[model samples]
Target chain A: MTGDTELRDRQAMMKAALQAYVDRANAGDADGLVALFAPDAVIEDPIGSPLKTGADIPAWFADTVAFGTRITPVAPLRGSHANEALLVFDVEFTPPGGEPMRIRSADACTFNDAGLITRLRAFWGPGDIEPA
Target chain B: MTGDTELRDRQAMMKAALQAYVDRANAGDADGLVALFAPDAVIEDPIGSPLKTGADIPAWFADTVAFGTRITPVAPLRGSHANEALLVFDVEFTPPGGEPMRIRSADACTFNDAGLITRLRAFWGPGDIEPA
Candidate 1:
């Protein structure tokens, strides 16, 4: 097969996986969210924070869901290459005691050959979110 | 041309433009940065802030450079589609009365058929930057 065709196939698979991820998050299913990543995937919810890997990723997702966080894509999900993608979206959250908030952010993700996310780097900060 | 080939060519052009933007910014040439934008382009340096258009874009670029800001790409620049790309980089700032700092952020830029930026949306927040 041609390289372009292969890349196209990979893009399709990743897009499907991302859609499923959004579905799970919106459903508040932490376990479903965790199932999307490879067992050893590393995730940095905010690019500057400490990395979460292995089982910690699930815990982090659980914490996010527990905080009433919901993610919705704000733009078309974009593929950077065959195994990498860009997800630009809005994240809504209601903190424990703070006002509800909405943030516009993007995440750059790298996937493994098996279509599992190997790394997820979220690009957002406190200033990115506004009171909703 | 095939869709894939056309996309690849457009991607190349956009990448070159982005590189030039970073180079001009690092050199403190705000005019050069403005040259990259369409005459009536709109730019939102941070997703939630006011939009900068036409002559305002140059003013914004001037203000940023006047603050001793320098940009350097920290990751491989990614193309989202034929005319849109993602630039993840760091912006260094030294304020008039503040210490030097560094910000990690991303910009989603849309290009016109003529290869100029028609809209540039920067994804960053007050929290994305850190003390250098």
Candidate 2:
């Protein structure tokens, strides 16, 4: 494949993966959500949190599912010319020991050549989260 | 300063800089827009395009100003735990040899410790652009 076509293919894959991510999360399917990541993927939900990798990933998503999290797209999924895609969404969930809250989250994901997400850095701060 | 406070300060600066970016762009102030960048900043306007830096930065904004680009924030500016912020906005402009168009762009910006934008990678694919 030409380099240009290959790049576009990668971009398409990343975008599709982002949509799948939302679907899986909304469906509360922790396994499906974890499957979107590479074997050695790393994630920082809310950016400032500790990194979650390997076994931490599955556990993290399980917590997310347990929180009854629901993600709603705020804008169209953004794809870069490279192996990155941005998902802008609003999340509503109740965290442990916390009230129901809505968070305006923008996840910046980097994908591997195989289109599995290798890194996900979610952008959200204390100010972005508000009581629902 | 404690690490937590320092990190929060950086996050605040990044988020403010993003709001300034939107304000400068909407006001058609190319100079103001360029001032937000660090001296050695780099930008990729559509992710797939060539990187603009140094002398190219001013010229790129000049073209942007000439196009009368109007930026409207679609979602609240998102701040990370680090020196990064995400700006999700819609741009309305007329490109050379093209009709008026609106692009849904998500700019992932990395900031220097001094709060200037050091790297800006905009994520927007062809499908994200629509006739305005």
Candidate 3:
């Protein structure tokens, strides 16, 4: 395969991996969500402190699920390079006693040669979310 | 040039252009700094509203100069794509009657085929700068 072809393939794999994680998060499947990350993956949540390693992803997902948050991946994942991809999506969170609030978020993911996500950096505007 | 070589050359040009702007800004050379942007360039400042043309950049720079801000571009400009670059740097501002405060900023710039910056978006932590 040509370099361009390889880069495209890598980008596709990265997108699929990110989609899988989002799907699991929306479904409240903590195990499936955690499985998407590499063993040494790092997650920097827009709120709270950063989580290093895949082991911490479950707790992070649990917190979101507990808040009844559902994430929808938006179209056209913008990639900066072959091994790096940026995914933008909208997420809706429903508090236990309040209405649902929608927030737009963009995540930057890095993949290793094996196409496993090694790092996930999430970006979101603080004003995008409102108290319910 | 090979694809890799071409990409490197483009990155170098971008770095030089950004450095020129920073140097001009530090020297309060408004005209020289504004020349780096395309006529239809857009600038999204970290605070307040966004500017949507090269003509607006002069006003933005003047505001910074009035604030007595000096910007330093850090090394290793990270490029996501061949035509796009992300620059992370630090800026220090001194108020008229107060001490100096430093803020770290990251800018994402897009270049047109002519190598002129068509868009410049600045990003910085809200807490990075302290009231002086």
Cα lDDT computed for each candidate against the true fold: 0.75, 0.88, 0.65
Residue B106 lDDT in candidate 1: 72
- Colliding pairs, model 1: none
lDDT of 3 by residue, A1-132 (tens): 226567567757776887787777888887787777778888865522345555567777777788887877653444433366655667888866778887655566778878788887665433335553
TM per candidate comes to 0.53, 0.92, 0.49
lDDT of 3 by residue, B83-112 (tens): 665555678887666788876555667887
Model 2 per-residue lDDT tens digits across residues B6-125:
877776788888999889999999999999999999999888678989999999999999998999999889887767789999999998888999998989898887899999999887
Give stretches of model 1 more than 4 Å off.
A1-31, A34-132
Chain B TM-scores across candidates: 0.92, 0.94, 0.80
Worst lDDT 10-window in candidate 2 chain A: A1-10
RMSD of 3: 17.4
Residue-wise lDDT of candidate 2 within A1-132, one digit each (tens)? 227678778878899999999999999999999999999999988776788899999999999999999999998888876777899999999998889999989998999988899999999876687898
By TM-score, highest first, what's the ranking? 2, 1, 3
TM-score of chain A of each: 0.92, 0.94, 0.81
Candidate 2 clashing pairs, residues 3+ apart or interchain: none
TM-score of chain B of 3: 0.80
Cα lDDT, model 2, residue B109: 90
How many residue pairs clash in all the candidates, one count each?
0, 0, 1
Ranking by DockQ: 2, 1, 3
